[model samples]
Target: MAVEVGTTEPTEDVIDVKEVTRAERLRSMVARHRAKARKAAEQQRVNVARRVNEWFTSTDVTDAELAAEIERKRRREQHQGERELRDRVRMLREQLRAADENTAPALSAQLTAAQAQLQIRQDEDADRMKVSGRDLVRARWMKRATRIGAVGAGSLAYVNGVAAEPLLALLSLGAAPVAWLYLGREFATDEAPVVPAAVGPDGTPIANAAVPGTPFVPDTLAAMGRVSVVKPESGRVQGEKDLVTALIKAGIITAAQRDETHLAGVIRPSGPGWTATVDLPRGVKSSAAVSRVEDLASALRIKKSRIEISADTTDDGHEGRFVLWVANEDNPYGSEKHPSRLIDADRWDFWQQGIPLGGDARSTRHEMHLLWSSLLIGGLMGYGKSYMARLVAAAAALDPTVRIIVITGKTGPDWAPLRHIAHQWIAGATPDIIRRVLGVMEQTIGEMQDRGTELDRLYEEDPESVPEGKITPELAAKGMGPVLLVVDELQELLDGAALVQVAIEDEPEGGGRAKARSGRDLMVEGFARYVRVTRFVGGMGVFITQRPDADSVPTKLREVCAKRASYRVKGDRSAKMVLGDDAVANGAAPHLLGEASKGVVVLDQGDEQGHVTLKADVIDLPQFREICLRGRQLRIDAGTLTGDALEYGKEDAAAAAAALLLTDCLAGLNAAGIDRARTERLMELLAFHHPGRYGEMTRAQLQAQLRDAGAGTTKKIGAVDGMANANGYTREQIAAAVKTGK
Candidate 1:
């Protein structure tokens, strides 16, 4: 390497190897350490400055945000309180308006004090708002001061060479004002003005005053004179608005009538539902609402069958008032059947307590007074017409003094249980059955006349006993009992198919020959007469028919029936026919009842309220039979069991048929307007009227049967039809044979 001419052998610059003293080495080390400490100190100063700036900036932002949040919360709370106060005022006003005179003064005082308190609270809120604004301004200024102080102290510490310690102390001191602005200032601010408690006229604080019947006890002076803050029971408050809206939408009321139409009282609990009284406009009758129940239900979001609308008859001047009952359940009558009250009772007093028919929609028990009123029940088939008829029969059967007569056009078992207690039980739609029905009618009429005669005698003998000229319970107890005549499926006897030949008394040109007439007319006339005459003398008629049309139940008969019940019918026309035009117009809408509403019926007993809808008690076959057996035992014990009940299954069927044939012959002779008829003509008449029974009867056979029936010996008689004299029988002989059979 030394051999190169210009390289100078890659010379190394030699450093001086100085061996330093201890003091010199220590100085070097101290200088290095001091430099390192200075760098760290600078970093600490930067960090402190950054933290102080951050604290100031964040504190300013947080103070502003906190003020805004506090204001928002205060406003929200204030608004809620105001709204609640307003609602309380409204509720108290409503209660005051509805309060009675006795409670009105107290309610007025409470209202006055509530108004005053509400005003005070509003004023207090306004004052608090103003005070809050001042405090907010004050807090903001203090925060700015604290921020300035923190910055000034840090700047001073940095300038004076005491950065870390003084800045830390300044931050600590600044926290005091920050904490005061955030927390202590709230306590230092002026408090809200307190409201004075309301005192009654007796100088007692209303907050301390005990309210009778109410559980209102105020805890605060501000709560004095205010209504109970508890919410209204159930949905009454909200339901009122919904009801009004629904009514308006249903066209039950006009928008202009909204003010006048309101709930009369609080919606209270009823059976399976809630009941409320709606006060409609003066010109709007309750029937308007009742007729539009479907529309109301639709608007109210409920089932039509679950809405029960009835006129409020409790007040005389309130035709616009009605009761609205809304059920929560789908079927308001419930799923289970309501058994008859008589099921548990051994006997019933028809004259005293009447019959416990069933309960109503409100679970209120209802009774049917069968003493002086005749009931006319009509509905579609299988819609409780026969069941109701049997209910009446069962009620009557429970009373041994009540003589029951069961006659059903249907030969079903519906009326069979009644046979055990019935004085005269007849079932069928045959010609013979019609003849027997007429005979029973005639006998009932004769008995009614006899009863009238006996009552007249009683009046003559003891005027006090027969003051009302009506049968008394005492008279009924002494063997002169009430009679209950139930005719189920009455349309069968009052239909066009039920025909008979009746003598035309006015048709003198026809030589007293009979003219064919609808047997319904005869039956209607007889029934009308029976109901008209017998209702006054301890006789109650219960006529039930599925077809409640004009032809089935004539107006002549329907008008006389004082009590009427209509089950589910085809339309309003049928309901009107059963319940009367007035009843239907007033608020009776049996047609609105659904087909599934079997035992439900609209009952109109000529009440002021027009009609009431209720579910009839169900008395099944077994219960009916049990009741009948008990009735039979009671009758036996009282020695009152008679007629069909006495010889229910003991009589010979063949002999009874023969006796009934003889009776039919008498009825046929009467219809022909002839006192005497030849045996052949009588047989022909019987065969023509009742062809199924006597279609193949020969003259010899008729004579032999008549002789066997002790209907007197056959003799030659003049034939009315320009024929030769033939062996014949007289009406007197037939009537004699009937009496002999009895």
Candidate 2:
């Protein structure tokens, strides 16, 4: 029996040892291969994810959408990985069950490894609870409670043993409940500090921070005071190079583009943020750049509302520049403080009694002198042209000595603020209304001519009394006051409206439309002809029109007017039409102005530089009405609220009509140094008005009448061929006699 057992043991031991060695070697090889395969598969999946993520650089999709897509892809990969792990584990278990007892150990080892891998996979999928801020807080509180309770209990035991005081023991025992409280692991929940959501310029919240690997999360989220945001460092403007890189990354500019497209000028601090003057690319116009200002601002990571992109173009339209005004805070214009009141006597004196239109972009007051300067204001619709006209009228109204005549052809509520103070407020563009306006214009011209003669007589009488060869503050104070002739929507009148309608009796025998003439002709010949010169005679005209065409706002009138302010217009053509020929060339690109730049205008007030940017005051309807009320009250108190159409007595009307006739007809006819008797052509001109009095009277009768009224004079005045001695009425002589009431 011993010999047999020895022989069997030797054979079995040899086979078992060989089998163990072979199986162990196979298992080790399989383990290495499995590790290598898993690593290679993971590397392949990482490569695919990397390739997919690279699409974000060129994709136009938002970051949030891209993150969602990446998350979906990762979820898909996770599910596939779990399925593969399950298949591997099932195959390993089957192989272990089919193996014989000797090789079973190797297969079992493989199965165990597979099972462990599956368990790790399942554990990951189980959504294990991570230690949150609340847990950490509770743990800290528990530790502190334990320490305090231990101290309390020790103190209680010591007090009871040393002092043997019953009261202290009872208090300590009751407080020793701290030990029981500390033994409890749970703690009441408290509000935890959390990262705040970031917001965009439009107040859109950016959910850019959550758990790591979550969708819509940033690579690095930072807390900036109360604003928790992604890439907070990128919000600050570093330099031009950084801006250029951002632009390129934002697809606003290509790297191949030249420096002009990338902003050639240096950026400097202007108010809140830096301002840079960038020359647009050769092919790109400034208007194009202005259009994309929002995109540019977004690329720079700035608030879109805090950016100002003003553009200037050359005459040839080949070159242009963009003035980029970027501010850290919103509302750059709000930073400037402007006076609310329109009338400041001190500022008025500094402006030589000019009107304060508004403040410029630099917050400096834009005081325009309408005394000896006509104004041509033109702009697009809704660009504050009518509002500007109201401002002028309001300014005139504040001065008791100034008269306001407003021609509001718009027929809208835009001029409601000026109704209280307007002297001759014409509100329609009908034929009869325009004809009446023409009559008003004719009457104003006649009055201006009369004032000119009056001024000349005053100067001749006393040069010191008439400081300049025009109406002074003293003259205006003395009641020979100023008149603001505001014509808004002048295009309506110039669009072939009626001028002066003649009656059938007054019409000539030619039988044409004799009485009805075009208003444009009468305006060009009569009104605009003398409008500029009348400023010196206390009558200033403001021609405001949305259409700045040759017919609407004639070039002749534009040439006469020394000051022009234009708002956003159609293009450079319209800007030039309103401002001047060199407006666009000199950086007055009204075309680049937009509704976003409301109240911004390009003013050319006879400055050597073409035009300047004037950010007009924000005159709301309520404020305007208040200003009008104040002005009206002022005029009423001063007793100088006389208007062109105010009710007057018969004597006053006759005197005013006689003065108009003397200057408009007599003086104008005698301007060529021609001598004529007062009873000849002068009486004839007067007889047309007072036909019943002097139509058939003799020259002797007219001379007697004038001498009785203290107006005629004997003078040697004639042309070279027709020199004669006669009784002629000089303007100064008539003015003096009329003033002295001789």
Candidate 3:
């Protein structure tokens, strides 16, 4: 922004422009920054559109009915072309080597013939723009464009007739580099780059645009689906480096070629195992590409298979993802994909948002909800939902602020973990429990509404107040903490007509003047509105369940489930029902559930623009087990556990693991970013109560246990630590403890 200023001295008669006030300047700066960001985002979208258009116009990629088939053809052609050149090179080298071995005329002839072939290959390579050649062209173009633009401008100035000899002399000043580049000789080999035939929007090749040997690039695994740094080697299995060495000895890959040719990256331990990446030479066939990805999977002891890619999974079928966690005994079923693997043809339960298997780092905690936003775990029998729920349950156990409540309809699998972390674990995701839970949530909702109202009042009262989101738990404690409601396999809640009926009976019509709104139809509608508009509460309404459809889910629940997580559906239309049309677009074949995608899910919701392939993250079962098993005794005062105290501390760790082995298991959990403090507190209680094999209690054991439990060591201290870390302790716990202690 600019402003005009008048000169006080009229003699100096010069009007000056001045910048506005500091606040205005700051706002202007912010606006400029935002504009720049918006422009960049727009440019990226334009790029994607352009790429999509290019593909759609290509011949080989235009067969929408058989896009993968077209991709396979192109890949085969490309691979053969590159391979022929490579084989010719190898033959030439071999002929030369044989000639060196013996003075044989046949070897000499072969060597000469090989050299001729080499010459031809080199010529083709130069024109074909091998990666190295592309690098040169890219570099030269940048330089040439810069120089020509600069020198051409100056030369035109001279051509158009410059003023004088003195001016002409200055004109050439600082233009030497431009002149050199402009006058430099350009070079081009005989070979020309063959632009690929355009691929259609459906990833099929366009007849006119199809390139002979282009590799099929299906950025998403459509049809089928599907943590940690727990190295998979069980002592007998080779360590990463040693295994790589062994592979080299076995002629799987040469040691010299490991980093550049075959596996381009170093071997590293990933969640539950080890893996490496291979960057195949350009123009490799689709089959070869599959072979490369498969070879790595084989080396890593992972299942090799093909997954169908869904078009609704973002425009390119490679967006909105996070993980690709492998399913095993511990996490038998998952809600969505995790960001671990880049690809998977295996059974998958869940996938993460913005994450792919074998592509990048593990998913972060804050992203868990967003990535699994489309996931909901629930089943009728034997506990399938628990497979993925453990991840959520375990997370809450570690973080106190994450107050998790697990309500399962059936007991086996879903009811396994969370006995420790979940403040209340219901073996049944039952109607009665739902009723009780609804009653509590109703209270919390009323409290939150009142708080929202109070915040408005405060703003009116002062005209300067903290924003709603800025309302901290501390402030909320003074008012009401944000309430979170998580129901597993919501089908049970749907079944509980009696409990639901009672709540309806108590519900007052015409907006009763009660402290909190009842769990009535209107209330459910209000909840829907809240979930849709308010992040603070929608964030709170991150409800989980096995059934993820309108029918399986109640009308009340469905209205507010703006975000849903899906594992696998039974059929194509079912997948559409679960993932929605825009998100799970896997062509005629629905990709999320069905026979093809057992574990993978197409995560979609009302607000989600589209779905994408996401591999689910692997859970740390050992750590989860430790938390649940020991969380029984790790007690803390909810009232006293204020501010930072709500955070887990060292005292918590020693107490929990005092009875367990001293392997860096705790470290693994922490490095994996599992709940560290709560794990400790829970472990502390387990050690005190179920002292493991250290069962033969001695005076020494008691002292050691007490010390680990944060009791002041020295013989003088008694059962204060033990008492503090007690079972069934609540708000009135201290009073009872004090009564007993005294």
Candidate 4:
């Protein structure tokens, strides 16, 4: 009844109770609003996340660039690098095609490059990132398969679109600056500048954020490219073996060169950026033949000098280092060379095809006389002038008829290596000492002249068919050993006018009055005489300096020099001075050194033409890692060399003291089953390092000689004398005879 009547329609007895309480209604309203607010907040957050993601991924629009271009100006360089890589690949293929040419042995240089490329591709495929695109147009396609697989097909379709379909893929490449600003993982503002490393105005670092007073970057360990995946390819390399092969082939090289060439390591980009590394030899001395050393170095930003080279030598031993600078540049960047360097490496006396000595009109004729011509070689401070010079002395020492004498003012780095070869030296800029030494050399020359005159008188007294035709080098070469003089850092000593004048005057003086004084003076004089007329005397003179100019070497000395070479010369004037007419100087060549910048020069030894524009040779501290490691153990001072190895004309040196110290050469030879002990004893006697003296004995007497070189007393010497007497060695018979009765 109550339900039927609208006015009395209260279901539960129509109690007059308010169903909504103000507080409860407010709470309910608040709850509903809170639910809506939560959804709105979640949506807001989702939108924010989406926006952040979008910020990372750019749309396919030409103007959607956001990141700052760090090295926007270097775009040209980037393109050049890519182009060079491509061209290199092409050239290597050509080399492989002509692998059988030349007599050096049939080696397909391209095969090695191709194999290396394939190997790198395999590595990239396994570890490289996967980016979505219809086709990764700029990205290199590295795969082991000739036919695209499911993964590759999907990737290609996503990036480049269907190969058969007419679709254009708009690539979103971030500017270099933007890449660093956003994509680069390095968060700290501490980053190296785009400029090179050098002392700033306040002597602070301008680029690198490296900590002070440390050799390497703090808290940083360079990643190494290890465990590469090598893909097997067919007879021809047209696919995956492209990039690496291109790297090897980019230089003007031959298939035979590659065949004989060894791969120390293949460098490749790594990590979240363009990181790369090189795997080196076990000893780091294992050498590799490269096309353009500068290009390789520049591309890798690695040191080009200090590249310890080793090649197959004769059993007796053969070694040599020559500067072939026909294609060198003075201002490399100004030239047409791509990448401006070799393989990201620093210039450290890295050899290359240099600039043409007489511009484009250059002759390939080389007329250098190994026995008679004085050669001039130079480079900047960081270049490899000193190292290369040392190598030259080493080469000279290999000849039995050559005697090396060294004089230097380079604070020991240069002189120490040649301790065995150098008869005289000063490691620092000591003009007075150097002058006195030169005086003694002049006196020695005078004495040699006197001896020659006396011999002529004797010959006249007893007529002979051979009349002395100037008693020239040709004659000397037939009888006597040639002399070699190496001066390291002549610039430091010949820095001032007074020093130069004094040095010039000192050449005429005999040694000082006293024994040590005379000895020092004589040694110095001997060194100078070697430089003055060594070539004419069937000898050689090697002059090394960071600064080579008219000032460092006076005209009196330069007149005879027929060869000019350098790793890199900083100044155009210096380049001209060292290279002579080859490049052109202010006096002889005005516009030849037109740009007048780093790594530019011309080389002329009379008509022989050579030129090179390049940065100084930088010791490849990476490949020379072993040498650097040995630097820890290098002794600042070194004494005279003594031993069987000290024989005439041997110029090679074992520079790393650590390696020498680590192993006993004698013991090693013994282990290799060589009879070094007997030879060592003989060495002691011949070098005068042992106690007993063989001053009067001749070479013929050595057959029967029994003098104990290690004997420290007269009694012991006498005992040895008795033994020698029994063996038919007589002091009177041998000592009284001059020239061993020859």
Weakest ten-residue segment in model 2 by summed lDDT: 218-227
Per-prediction TM-score: 0.56, 0.46, 0.37, 0.33
**Candidate that beats the other on TM-score, 3 or 4, i.e. the better one:** 3
Indicate the TM-score of model 1: 0.56
Residues 263-309, model 1: lDDT tens digits:
65444444445677788988898889978977887786666777777
Q: Write the per-residue lDDT of candidate 2 for residues 1-742, one digit (tens) a residue.
A: 4554433344443457888899999999999999998987666566555533433232223232233344445447656776686677667766876889999998878776766675465445323223233443444455456666776898778866758665766776787556544433232233122333435558775432222211222212221221121223333544455556655655645788646564433333333345655665576666555556557767877655555555543343234665666654543454332333352111123125455566543334555666777788998878677666666666676677777777867687766656666677788877788678778877878887898999889889999988878787788777777777787887877773644443424557876544555566776665576676687777678889888777777887888888888888877688888988755554555666655666667787775434666666555667677666666666667676555334322344566645554454345445535434444666666566567655787877656655655665455545423445544665666666557552
- Model 1: colliding residue pairs: none
Once fitted onto the true fold, the runs of candidate 3 whose alpha carbons sit more than 4 angstroms away are: 1-385, 393-399, 412-419, 429-434, 457-465, 468-482, 498-500, 503-539, 547-550, 581-598, 605-609, 625-742
Residues 1-742 of candidate 3 have per-residue lDDT tens digits of 8999876656765644454476678999999999998986666566555543443343212222132333344446654664574566456545555665465666566655654554354334323422232343444455456555776787877866655455765666668656544433232232123334436458765442122232232112221111111223311122234434433543445677444333322323322223333332233322332223335335445433222222222333232211122222122223444322211111111211222211111211222442212233332223224444554444334333344445554566544555544444555535456565555555545655665676666667764444544444444434333333455555554455223444334445777643432233433454454454434531344445555456555445454455544555444455445444434432222222333344443344345343333334444455455554333333243331222223334434554455242223233334444332222343454355556643455545644553443332332222233553433212122233223333
Identify the superior model by TM-score, candidate 2 or candidate 3. Answer: 2
lDDT of each: 0.73, 0.60, 0.40, 0.37
Model 1 ranges with Cα > 4 A deviation: 1-237, 496-498, 504-512, 652-742
Instruction: At residue 449, give the lDDT of candidate 1.
Output: 80
Candidate 4, residues 1-742, lDDT tens digits: the string is: 3555445454666533465476678899999999998986666566555544434342211110111121222344444545665566556655655665582233454445544554344334322222223222222122213123655676766665634444343232334345434442322244222222334347764331211111111111111011111111111111112322433553423334433332222211111111112222233211232224444434323333311112322243222211111112223234332221222211111112211121121111111234555566676665445544433443343333344456566563444544444444445555566665465457546644654565466467854523542333333334344555666666665552134333223333566532223333333345445555434334566666666667665555555666666555544466556655424421222123333333332334444223323322222323233232122122111222323224422433322322221123233333444332232343334435323434454543443332211111111222232254222222232222322222
For model 4, what is the error of residue 459's alpha carbon versus the real structure, in angstroms, after optimal superposition? 8.8
The C-alpha RMSD of each candidate to the native structure, in angstroms, is 27.7, 32.1, 34.6, 23.3
